[model samples]
Target: MAIFKHLRVSDGVAAQGDGKLPAGDPDPPPAADGAHGPPVTNEPGSTKAWTWRGDFGASLVVVLIAVPLSLGIAVASDAPLVAGLISAVVGGIVGGLIGGSAVQVSGPAAGLTVIVAGLVQTYGWAATCAIVAAAGVLQLVLGLSRVARAALAVSPAVIHGMLAGVGVVIALSQLHIVLGGTPQSSALDNLVELPGQLASNHTLTVATGLLTLAVLIAWPRLPQRVRVVPAPLAAIAAGTGVAAVLGWDVARVDLPSDPLAALAAPQWPDASWTSVAGAVIAVALVASVESLLCAVAMDRLHDGPRVNLDRELTGQGAANLTAGLLGGLPIAGVVVRSTANAKAGARSRRATVMHGVWVLVLALVAAPAIELIPLGALAALLVAIGVQMVNLSHLRGVHRHGELPVYLLTMAGVVALGLFEGVLIGLGCALLLTIRRLASIAVRVTPQHGGPVRVAVDGSLTFLSVPALLRALTAVPEKAVVDLSLNIDFMDHAGVTAIDDWRTGYERSGGTVRIDEVREHWYAPGRSGLPRPVRRTPPVRNRAAWHPLAATLSGRRQLEEGTEEYQSHVAPLVRPLFSELAHGQRPTHLFITCADSRLVPNMITSSGPGDLFTVRNVGNLVPRHGEADPNDSTIAAIEYALAVLPIKTITVCGHSACGAMDALLTPERAGNMPYLSGWLRHGSHSLDRLATRPDGPDRLDRLGRENVLQQLDNLRTHPAVAAREAAGELELCGGYFEIAEGRLHILSPAARVPV
Candidate 1:
């Protein structure tokens, strides 16, 4: 059986009997040659030396490209050319020694050009270096704490799309340089001058650059053996050689006098409180973004090998800190070089270190030869690199996924503003798109198969949802029984009001409605009642029988069913008033009254349930049908009583000094009392009704009666009621409830009457 050891690169490998290779050893064995292999103490001794010969050819080609790129990026970032070389060396050597991914190469990345330039312009170079040191420390801490996992939490789509966007930006910016035109320092300036730059500089240099691009595109299609050479390198070599031999008068990097003397330690800046703080934040963010992105790419390429992102970040930070101290710019994990290393058969961190060694050796030995390379040629190389980074395929994928708006908006924002701000805007758009997708589906309230109609609203319902409710209610079959249930935790006032209106309308249209368990509002705990000035009592304990009735009464216990208190307190008064209702032409009228106990329809109409055929609910609401299935019972009962029983007159009695009415009158009070405030909006018509009535009694009383009258008018608008009324069989009446005197006054054309 193989003894599993962490030191072995492959899983399930046994450790050697002797203490040799240990975990965390930076120098590990190469997978090919046995020379200079680190001995394995824990894992079975496997003598394998990492081969560099196979990659020598590829590495040579990469160095050609890397040299030019390093200089160009340094120039772009407003840093000394040696800074780029230092970064490349440190990134490869120090980063490779500590980084989690074996094949990833670290260097001064082009993506940092914009950030470094900005930092230099804002804070002096010294401060930026200090910040870079701090950022390195932060990355080290992050790696030790394993905080790099957070980078993986970003959505795959977002990361890919971001990379694609970055690619496009890079490609566009390089176009000017490729055509032998001077590049603008700022992204905005470059974009603004692109067309004019192209128009003015349409020279042979442009043709040569395009031809180079074409050759790069066709290189992969060449024979399999020939395909080993990367397209970009070949393209650069061809383009640069042609331009040089032809002596094209194109823009080129002019080597400074005493290039070797420029490679000195960077001066440390005065670390002020503000400058340090700003630089640290900027460096941390930029480095984190770049390093984590490279780590993720390497992870995918490794077939899901866990990447120590924090370790990678720490390596990056360390590199940056060293680079800053050595008078070099900040550095990060560069995708181009990392990819190149991976493709070149790098088996361990040795390849990265070797790449750094190569850069250092070349810098020391071939410094003069590097000066011979033209800036325009390097610019063309950079242009090629930038073009390769642009991922048009990813953009197409985003469009295909129906996230075109996100793609376009993000691209536009990045192009117009800058990277960070553009990403923020894109995030906002993405959130909005998510909400819209969630909101698109309507909350359906309908009967379940062989069960009561269930109204299912999965999301938030607000004023904006009113039209949906209205449309839904109007679509229900007028004759079918409905069980309206509002199973939502959050419902706004407009939604509640819409529900009330629907209830009233559904009942009037000869449909049944029922309201299931409705959570009580904190301020207004009882059922929704008429606007009135009355003392409120705590709700009764037994809810099954009385809760529904009590909710309809808005906490006034005077009209409770099966209660000795109600019989003693309210029966005597109602019996006398209802005597006239008993003999009033077979009770051809049904009045739906507010649940407020003080506004008893019997007292107002001088009728019993048999005489007036009354139905009561909190706020005397007529909510739209099918808004919720809980309302089905209430609606069905009303429809059965009005349409089946075929009542001639339907009245909605509102009372003065009513809770619902008062709640509606003062919005602040409603705010203080949420549930009641939401329910009270149903009674807004009371204000209109009161306005139409002449001043009489207390204003609340007048308004209460007027509101009842207005509700009567609203009831007439119901399809069933309108049809019945048009047939000369139905009529509407309005009445006001007086809580103080325990009296109900009906509103007649001539005068108010205590029926």
Candidate 2:
């Protein structure tokens, strides 16, 4: 066993990953040699490892479970039982030796059962081996070109749909074998002949199949101690005993005790070259895709090492080639064994390799005992797995996300037609859904008070959206002026023609339509037949990027199609108020609050500029009446707003995440600046109020509410404020702003509630 380690060459030194270090986080720290993580060398017994004992134990458990699964998948795929054992050995040895992943197990996966069956039926068994070899070459080339990741670029819905389709096919065909009837050639044929198969099954064969199925389905619910034997093994063991006692005529796996003497040689294909070539490419693509996806899922198990997908692909290719040469079943990464390996505390790929070695040893040493597994028992195990593959929970999750249509369409196509056709239709559905989303439109018709009705359209407009847009436009009052605000990202000729035709008809009926394009020109208006050159809107310039007078004309076209109410209507209404207040201002209240942009004093108080005097600071804190500090910005504003203006009340407000309150709680923040730090000394009074509550994430908001009350008290300390309030001529109050709800909350002595 090798120690858990990794390396990367940066500068002159190799960066190393320590297994003990925290690496599970998405953002890991820079490596020791300061290079992005690179591959570590894999070796055996380089040193006494931390988890050698655990890895060894895990290997034993995995081999026991893998043996039954391998045999069952081979039976389902119609391959020779020895081919399953051969694939397992080659997968463990070749795949584990050179794979990029640390612990993902490669073996004869059930995912490829349908593909293998099709290949074997079309070509002879020996020629199918040749096709597997050809497919391995494709995988090797793909890995060498570092395009393994590209296999996962297809939509996950399509992949899952294809798998579910395969599952239904497996269950339908394998059911016939389980019931002691010969299976039909295809899923469609199986479905048509299923009723006849059910009517004419041997009584003893049905009993054996039912017993095997019951054991498999009930094994998970068994007591933990009794489950020490794996589910597949337990089910097969029970079926074998029952068949012997009843003297049932059931099919069983036939294998020679001397496995080496029974190995067959690969033969060249005698079928059409086109059909053979298609099978080879399909096998290669499907196998590579499944392996890569399994490796990615397994990566979350260990922080010890990240997988190199390209290298893992190369490893799988090598393993498959070796398996094919030996006339074995094709192999790919198996998630069940990989998950078991991870759970069993596998620290390295050594465990993965050892599991394969164990299977090889078992096949050669105990071939007679392995031959006792009943074919109906294996089919029973496969039936359970096939049902699981069409998981209803996963389908419900897909349905919740509006993807049921795609999944159902793919499944139906595959079950009724073929794999290639089903996948094409599924992919085609996904593409159409994507196109629909990209060409969707959102249109709103708002009737302005004593003004033209505003028809606002957002998102791209294509031919698909034209009919809906036309229907929506018909509701606008006849012979009325319409403000058409189009903020479209893209527009095609069909869309342009629809809108132009509608506008022409509307105008012909004495209705007026003004088209204002936002951001960029999507189409040329009034010149509908001509091809309009598309152009992108220029990026807005920042203050630093601005030239002399570009700001003056920027909003002219934008305001014509803008969402800002001030630019369209409010500014004109407020100009008269601004003119009257320009000479001098008289406000009734002096409002003090945080300088956060969202905390607008006028908006919160429902007051115009002339209605209230404003004072804004970091925390809305007020110092007690005493000697003035060097930082007097807030105090100066308060004094002027109180003495110079006709202010009748003083309102102090604080808000969530008040910078001053946070600074008060965390003292270290004050270390860098002496002036702002000293200025925040007024906020310390709010900390004294914190003893009322337990310390937690909500402490800042609690302290902020208290700070406002403290500031209100501080206002009373000022002689001018005290004298006016003493005479009952002025009012003082406190409040905090709730950012989430956009409501002002008053902090009363008894409780804080929204007003």
Candidate 3:
């Protein structure tokens, strides 16, 4: 066992960048030395040493399940029973020793049964083997050329549909054998003959088949300890025992006296070269796809090494070549055996090779015992496997992604025509769907009799949509005004040329046209001759007029112009978010700040559109629960915040050079201003604290920090605020922003001064 374990070759392995091996991730160097060590699972993305103990135990579990499944798949393909065991051995020994994935087990999968059966019928058994060998050579070339990853680009819907179609064909044909009747060649023929086969009486065979299926279904639901024996093995054993005890006359599995000596050899077919080449390509593509898909699925089952896909493809090619020359069925990575190996704690490739060794040994020594098992039992087992292929969860996912049409057409093509034809149909459907979606651009023309006509274009603007744009433009009357707002997310040269030509021709006829690009500038750059933009860069907003010059216009005119700019350029882009917020506001923070013109809460906090619930009053004050007038709007706002919105944090922000704080210090400043003096009374608490703690660079700065702290204390006076704070559900924070330096300081209760 240990001698065979050293045969794992380092073909595509390379050390990762972190200077440490990934835990249980095998990337052995060329001499195969230092491969074994103490296994440990460290932090995420860390490496551990490989262990043989896990591999040895996992091989036993996988081999037990592989033996029965291998024989059944070969029987379904209408080939010699020994061919199944031969493929099993080659898939494990050659495939595992060099394959990319650490734990995925390869064998004769049920997915290729229909293809193999067709090959055997068209080109004799020996000639089919020769075709398989040729396909293996093609796969080797593909792997070496590093095109293995490109196969994954095929849609998963097409792949799933192909498997489901194959499963249906296998189940239909295998059902005939379970019912003690000969199966017809195609799936349709089998269905047409099923009713008559069911009418004929075959009580003993039916009993044996029912017993096998019952055990297969019931084994999984049993206690965990009893299920240590694999379900397939247990199900077959029970059915065979009953048949022998009843002394029923039934067809049973037949094997040569010496299985190794009776192995078939490949031979060239005497058919057309074109037909043979098609067979080879079909076999190569289907087997490659099945094995690659299985390797990806098995990777999610273990925390061991990630599969090296290109290396795995090369290994599978070598295995298929060996299996074909030795007169075996085509091989692929089998999910059942691979899943068993992973669940049984397999850690390395040693388990995969050892399972093959076990199968080879059993075929050489256990010929007589295997012959005792009935063929009906294997057929019954296959029926269950076939039914499971049409998965409901996969159907739902296909529907959700809008690929149901492709999936259904592929499955129908495979069942009615063949696998290759079905795949071509599916690919065609997917291409048409993609082209339709890309060309479906939106062009709306809103015409006004005496005013400027509005034309809005959305979606990708390509050559396909150029006609639609021109038709909408022709609707506007000659010598009329037009506003063409292009909110295009993507565009090509043809689309740009179409729009430019239309605008030039229309303006020559005495029409006015204005263009506004909302987000991406795909048109303006080309029209201005500023080196046609290849990338969709955002249009920068010019803020030169934010503080307009006296010669330019008054401040009121500047504000009105800003509003017009927002409506023409920014409104369409932000409309989606604003539409959702129109229903209600769900602000998470309640912000209390001074009513100073310089303090913009949204800009300072970096929030936009219904993020902050703000309350601005004189002194940035939050009066104690009942101190102010009963009709106070500030108190009412706080009560509404606590009662309605999901407010989690309450922030009080104070700033430097505050006019309110200066007013608080000098009563004479506000002596004549009645409203200003009345609002200054709220700063009395902040004034008392200023005298107790006077350590600052300036009186105004010191008063600002004290006011922020005093307001936080006053907020706790509310019953809801006090209760939520005591329970640790709500938080209170203080911040002070300096105007000159543009810096913010966070204040805590322990420190009277800002830090």
Q: Which model scores highest in lDDT? A: 3
Clash pairs, candidate 3, are 22-47, 23-46, 23-47, 23-48, 100-312
Each prediction's TM-score against the native? Answer: 0.53, 0.64, 0.71
The digit string of per-residue lDDT tens for model 3 on 267-383 reads 998999999999988888888888887788777766556788899889888988999999999888877787778778787899999999999999988878788888999888777
For candidate 1, which ten residues in a row score worst on lDDT? 6-15
Pick the winner on lDDT between candidates 2 and 3.
3
lDDT by residue (73-190, candidate 2, tens digit) is 7887888888888888888889999898987888887778888987788787898889888888888989999998999898767766777788778778778888888788889899
lDDT of 1 at 312: 81
Score candidate 2 by TM-score against the native.
0.64
Count of backbone clashes for each model? 69, 0, 5
In model 2, what is the error at residue 245, expressed in angstroms? 6.5
Residue 74 displacement in candidate 2 (angstroms): 1.5
User: Candidate 1 lDDT, tens digit per residue, 1-755?
Assistant: 01111111100010111212222222343334453344433433433323344245435545654665677677666666777887888887888888887656778776666567667777667656666676777777777777777866654345444443544455556667667676676567877888898778877767666666666556655787885665555665676677678887655444445545665554455657776665676566666766776766655433213567777877877787777776677777766565555555555677777778788888877776666455555555555455444344445666777776776666566666765656666777777876665444255655544333445443455665567767776766665556554434345566667777777787887876766422223112222643422332332234545333344443333332235334433465578767866664455677788887555466555554666676887767654433424645446766777656757777777666776666655678668767666555556766766667577557755555556656666566557877887898877776666666756566784565446
Full ranking by lDDT: 3, 2, 1
The TM-score ranking, best first, is 3, 2, 1
> For model 2, which pairs clash?
none
Off by over 4 Å in 2: 1-48, 224-229, 241-249, 448-619, 622-755
